[model samples]
Target: MQKIMLTGATGLLGRTLYKTLVKDFEVVGTGFNRATPPLYQLDLGNQQAVIDFLEQHQPDALIHAAAERKPDVCENEPEQTIALNVAASEFLAKQCAQRDIALIFISTDYVFDGKTPPYLESAQANPLNLYGQSKQRAEQAVLAHSTRHSIIRVPVLYGDVSELAESAVSVIATQISATQTTAHDNWAVRYPTHVEDIAFTLRDLLKRPENLGGIFHISDNQAMSKYDMACIMADILGYPQSLLEPLDEPSQSAARPHDCALADSRLKQLGIAHGREFKEALKSILLTA
Candidate 1:
């Protein structure tokens, strides 16, 4: 079996990917601050530690999923963000290049400002926050260090393993199950991809290793606001629509991307089919959980 080194194995997406990838690959999942499958206490900010880990493992490929995801945290600590997102990625990419290994980096839709809807892979990136800036810099460093790299830019993702899972559709389901009235009235538009879809897509991309040199946008076919997404989740979980509360835009503290949808034409062209619709995906997660 091919050896795959996966970073951020304890994170929401990382856990899901680790579970999916373990079946087919010798997955060595590394955790920065948590424990999960193939767990390693490897902090990416420590260059020598990362180098030692990579040199010892000598995996066939590397999947960089670890990140400082919170925009507010990245904003507060820009230097830390740079260290983890940019410097670590650069080191990993250089190491992978030297070893002739493929590298897959996870990026976010936030790299593009909300002014443009449905950003393409070729679109110019103008990050509005420190988190996005860090990811953008990481992407650049990876591309600069290695040509055998794939950058996947995903939209708002929600599923069982996600940090926002409980607070997302799961929250509504739990509330409805407990007969508690809940309101989800936030008007921020985004294409929320399921974690399962992302995992599957990454696996597919891994199979065709030659397609490892460009950016690809992975997301659902349709777009919806947070309010709309909440309603959909409620309906899927058999919650009454009357219990749903829609909040105005002014209510949110973080600067949101009003229309951060992505066009998955490249993914389709690569013959990687989308897994499920947003609602169907949410229902699957709820049922499985």
Candidate 2:
């Protein structure tokens, strides 16, 4: 079996990918915090530590999901965000290139400034916020360091989580379950892709490393506002949809992309079909919860 090193194993997407990939690959997982038996604690901000970890493990491929993802926090702490998102990614890409290892960099839809409806893999990135700029720079670094790399850009994602706050989708479920007043963004639209779909897609991509390289946008084709998502969660979980308060384009310290939905026809063209629609995945998560 080929070996894989997965960073950010404690995160929503990282944890999901780690679990699914372990079924077929010898997975070495790491997280900054909440390190368990298999997942080691590694400070990705420290360049030498990341290099040392890669040298020691020597995995055939590295899936980098670690990043400072909070838009507000990233705007406030540009230095720290750059340290983790851009600098760390550059270091990883360089090391992977040296060893001829496959590198899969998890990116975000924020790279596009929401001006375009459906961004293709070939679309030029024009980030509006610090978080998007950081991720965009990191994507460029990966491309510069190696040709054998996959930069997968995803939109809002949620899946089965031990805690509701772990993801945006689950957070809505938690709020409605408690019958608490929740605010939803009605203006800003996003593609709510499940983490399971991303995990399955990543697994399929890794299986054909030779055929997969360069940038790819992977997300469900459906576009819905946050208010719409809240309503769906409320309808599915038997909670009153009235509990969700619709806000029209609320102000944010960090500028948000209005419509950052991604197009995943590239994955379809590559013969990898992802399972579960948004409604189906949301129902599964809430019902099981």
Candidate 3:
């Protein structure tokens, strides 16, 4: 079996990726602060440590999934964001390129300005926040280093979480309650995708020889705002939807795109897709959580 090395194995999407990919390929997981016994403890920011880890494993493909994902946190800690998002990623790409290891970099759809509705893989990146800018830089570094690398951009993710607040989508459950009023953003459009679907997409993409080292978009087609999501969660959790209030203006401190609907044309052409109904899937997740 071809060995796969995955970073951020303890994270939301990385956890799912590890679980899904391990079924086919030999997956070696790594984490920094929360790493367990099986998952190697390696800091991506440490150049020598990362180099040593890569040389030790010599994986067929390395999925660089570790990143400072929160826009607010990234905005507050610009240095930390650049170190992890840009520098670490650039280092990994260079190391992977030298070793001839297929590197799959996990990226965010926030790379676009959201002026356009659906962005193709070839769309120019015009990030509006530090978080997006860092990822954009990383994307450029990866592509510059090797054609053997791939970048998979996904939107807001929701999935099996250790806690309710773990994912942006699942965290909506926290804001909702039966007796109290809650407010959510109705202005910014979001495509909340399941992490498992992204994992499955990567699994399928790895099997195909033609599209192994190119840009791909993986996201759910269902478009909804935070208020729309809150309404659905309220219904599922038996909370009154009437208590929910929609804010039709951008309220967050970080500048977010209005709508960045990723058009997965490449995946479509390759007949590679995996998705779930947002309502039903989220019901199962919320109930389980």
Q: Pick the candidate with the highest TM-score.
A: 3
- How high is the lDDT of residue 221 in model 3? 96
lDDT of 3: 0.94
Q: For candidate 3, give the lDDT of residue 288.
A: 93
lDDT digits (tens) for residues 108-192 of candidate 1: 9988887878788999998877888889988998888777888999887777844334334455455443266666646667677
Which one wins by TM-score: 1 or 3? 3
lDDT of 2 by residue, 190-257 (tens): 78888888999989988887776798888887878878888998888778887788889757789999
**TM-score preference between candidates 1 and 2, better one:** 2
Model 3 stretches astray by more than 4 angstroms: none
Worst 10 residues of 3 by lDDT: 205-214
Q: Pick the candidate with the highest lDDT.
A: 3
Better of 1 and 3 by lDDT: 3
Colliding pairs, model 1: 183-245, 185-246, 185-247
Alpha-carbon local distance difference test for all models: 0.79, 0.87, 0.94
For 160-237, candidate 3 gives per-residue lDDT tens digits of 999989999999999888999989999999999999999999999888745788788998999999999999999999
Per-candidate clashes, comma-separated? 3, 0, 0
Q: Which ten residues in a row have the lowest lDDT in candidate 2?
A: 170-179
